[model samples]
Target: MERRKVDVAVIGTGTAGMVAYKAARKHTDNLVVIEGERYGTTCARVGCMPSKLLIAAAEVAHQVAGADMFGIHAEHVSIDGKAVMARVRRERDRFVGGVLETVDGFPAEHRLQGMARFIDDHRLMVDEKLEVEAGRIVIATGSRPNVPDFLQVAGDRLLVNDSVFELENLPDSVAVFGPGIIGLELGQALSRLGVRVRMFGVSGNLGGIRDDAIRQYALETFNQEFPLDPSAQVNRVERTDKGVRVTFTDKPKGKSPSEVSEDFDYLLAATGRRANVDHLDIQNTGIELDERGTPIFDHYTLRCSKDHIFIAGDANKDVPLLHEATDEGRIAGDNAGRYPDIRSGMRRAPLSVVFTDPQIAVMGLTLDQVKERCKGYYGVGEVSFEDQGRSRVIGKNRGLLKVYGERGSGLFLGAEMFGPAAEHIGHLLAWAAQKHMTVTEMLDMPFYHPMIEEGVRTALRDLNYKLNIDPQMIDRALECGPGA
Candidate 1:
């Protein structure tokens, strides 16, 4: 058995783990990154980059199919799923190859195709033979799709995000169970690709999002764009001779509980995801895990109870966005390299974005969080995608940007936007919220005229109106008025 020693041992080469490894390399030459699988993490192989590539391809196919609507005559427009899959694979390989090339030249050793298990507090058994001892360890073992015990996933018919991408043939119809970011993005993309897709979720709409106006807009846009029935609940999934059948029960309030079934060539089970911590064996190390089996880290420093072991990314549980994971990883890497008393300088609020057609982006607190924090707190905001001239020109008029602020202090609590450029602007609002910027500060900034940013100005104007400020104070000279 080979024995190795390092200053830091990073598990899982995903976005978060990779960032930690890169950061730690600068501080110490004794670093090792262990990946269990042959390929890179979800984002590189299945989750973000590949999924977005497929969505872009679908969008192009949609536009080409509708060329006749704009007086450009075209007939028998079709898509080759195989070619699209090939391109997706090629792009994925290119990305993974680039990362691997960079890591190869680094001073730290790369342990590809190896699993790490804790042999002791400071010792880890890699690939069942090699013994590695490190002073500090960082866990970034991403996440996996959460398939319920009741649902059985057979080879061809049932699929998760990972297996769905490797499909040789596209399903003519699909029943997606869950109204999450994954479900919405993949469901909408498949629908646009001519798949008869129906999404079923126990919740009324996208869960974890507090903005009702934006939720309503998403529901409306999904129904208008695809075959969506938000009022249905999936009872169970079963495989049959014809295909896979999804049994659904109708919502209450005089709605019949009839068992509605749909047969599809394939079914995508994107209900949700759970942290990939099953193999870590934290019980032996005296580390704590939450109810959902995720590591419990200090909210401020991201350190586990064991001072030398830090956890970040999906393994930490609460914030699961890619950007959040990267940020948390950086904090853990920086803190792990220093002494115990040195604080991890990372306390910024996270921003989340759902990559659907219109793209839903949210940051900081929602109105519910504000109300819970303060009993007599009042929220003021605006909701409108139609008010922006950019939305009209782009021909996508579906979404609303609402900014919530504390009434007395005029401090921005949070912001939610759903529109063509909502994702980009949502980050801007998140920065403002983190910096404690006021509405007046946002209004004073120079914005390009006739752009989607006009929606931000409109939202601030509406917030000012709700605050009962004099309209004259926000005239063209102040650039805080509705059209200013």
Candidate 2:
């Protein structure tokens, strides 16, 4: 067997692994990055970039379909499914190629191609062909779509986000399971692109929002475009000659639930993702593990039980976002390269965004989290986009934005939003949360007239008043005009 030694070794060369390798290289020349699969980030390859490309197409289709509301008539708005899929694939390949180029630029000697499994705390075997012994190891193996065993009934008719982008043409209908981030984004996109989509979730969780009002608003808004059961009672899934068939109970509001069965070209499972650590043989490492067999590690340091072992990115499952993964990878790599001198890395305020239309976003502490931490020592402020100026002007006014504040300090704890331009608004709220800005302080920030951000200001104003810091407005002085 071939044997090698290194100062530090990083497993999986995705986003986290690449960042870890670069950070470790700064500390030692004897470091190598291992990749069992093809090079490229999940985002560029399948997750964020490619999904957004599909969403962009869907957005265009939706805009043309809705042009009549603006006194403009659009004729023959035919959607070419084949053409849409073609562009999605072509642009997806371009993104993946860019990531591949970056991987190619890495020093050849520092890259290893093989599946790595732990033999001991500081040793690993790569596909039984090469053995590696390192002073420190970092696991950044990323994650894959988690498919439930019951869905196996769909057999060849099953599809995941990874395989969806590979389609030659859009299907006539799709049954999307799990109304989480992936499900909502893909389900809505496909529906807007003229595909019949029925979405189901195990529980009533829409876009991962914690605030009840916002979640309800999102549920109502999405249901208007397509059938969405955030909480579904699915009976069975079977593969038919043509495709997959699903049986479930349809529970319409204020009516008795009825059992129904439907067939679709495919059953898309977007339930969630599982970290790619199970195959790593982590048991051999003698590290403390959680019930899920994932390593229990410090969030700030990204260190496993062993001083020389570290975990980061999706492998750690702390925060699965791309930016969070990048940050964790750097921390793990820096700590792994400089073992025995572990230091806590800076972690940013938590932020998450769902790219569905009228995008959904949650930043900093969620309402549930705040309640658990502060024990009802907080207040909530809300604004609905139904009457917001710019939103009404664009006919994109749907959903709500709720901001939270501490009762005593009037601190802007966090926010959950489902409204137009939420992606941009989420970033602004995240920045404010990170800066420890207060509710009144956020309101003090200039909000230009007739902008969507004005909605945010309105929420903060309500929060400021709720926090008992600002008087309840008797006069509508801030109102620039109707809808403004």
Candidate 3:
């Protein structure tokens, strides 16, 4: 067997792994990155970029269909399934190609092509062909879609996000399971593309929104577009001669609910994901693991058990977003490269966004987190888009925004918003939270008229009053004018 030694070794070449490799390279010349499969990020290959491309197409179709609300008419707005999938695949390949180029540019000696398994804390065996001993190690193997075994009844008709983009043409009908971010985004997009979609979730959750009012509003709004059961009692999922058959009990709001049977061309599983550490045989490393079998690591430093081993990105399953993965990778790589002289990396404020029609976003602390951390000293401010001038003007008068602040200090704690332009608004609030700005201070920022941002100002004003930092708002005085 071939034997090799390096200062640092990184497993996986996805976003986190790639970033970790680069970060470690800055500290030492002896570094290697291992890949067992194709070299591309989950975002570029199956997670973010491709999914957004599909959603973009769906958004165009939806806007054209709803143009009549603006006194404009569009004729024969047809979506070609083959053409849609073709563009998605074609553009997706372009993104993946860029990642391949980056990986190719890495020094040949620093790239390994075999699967890596732990032999010990500082040792790894690659496909039983090579043995590697390193001073430090970083694990960024990322994650894969977690499909329940019961869904196997669909057999060949089942699909995950990885395979969904590979379809030649969109299916006529699909039964989507899980109402979290993935399920909600894909289900809504497919529905807009003229596919018969029925989404189901075991728990009454919508887009992972923590605020009750926003979750309820989102549930009602999405149900208007297609059938969705947040809490479904599925009896059986079986394969049919043509495709798949699902038996369930759906409880519709304000109606007699009973058993229902449905058939679809495919069963799309948007259920959560499992971190890829299971295949590494981490138990051999003597690292402490949680009940879920994941390594116990420090969030700030990304250290697993000691200074020599680290875990980052979805492998840790702390924050699964791409940006968080990138940051964690940098921290882990930097610490691994520096080893005994480890230092904590800068951790940013919490922020999450779901790119649905109305958009769902949360910044800094969530309502639950604030309640727990601040006890009974936090106040909430809210604004509804139903009558907001800009929202009414744009025909996007749906959803709500709630901002939280501390009662004593009037410091902005966090926010949960299910409303228009939330993706952008979430960023602004995140900046404020990171800077630890007060509610009155955020309200002091300029507010432009007839824009979605004005809605944010309204919520801050309400929060200011609730925190006793300002007086109550006057009736109808907040809005500028008709459709302003």
Best-fitting candidate, measured by lDDT?
3
lDDT of 2 by residue, 137-172 (tens): 999999999999989788878999989999999999
Ranking by TM-score: 3, 2, 1
Least accurate 10 contiguous residues by lDDT in model 3: 475-484
Query: What lDDT score goes with residue 232 in model 2?
Result: 92
Candidate 3, superposed: residue stretches over 4 Å from native? 469-484
Residue ranges of candidate 1 with Cα displaced over 4 Å: 64-76, 108-113, 153-155, 205-207, 250-257, 468-484
lDDT of 1 by residue, 61-145 (tens): 8778767655787877688877877888889778778767755665434554588888877888888888889988999888889
Model 1 clash pairs? Answer: none
Provide the overall lDDT of each model, using Cα atoms, as 2-decimal numbers: 0.75, 0.89, 0.90
lDDT of 3: 0.90
Count steric clashes of candidate 2: 1
The count of backbone overlaps in candidate 3 is 0
**Model 3: residue 217 alpha-carbon error in angstroms:** 0.4
Return the TM-score for candidate 1, rounded to 2 decimals: 0.90
Candidate 2, superposed: residue stretches over 4 Å from native = 469-484
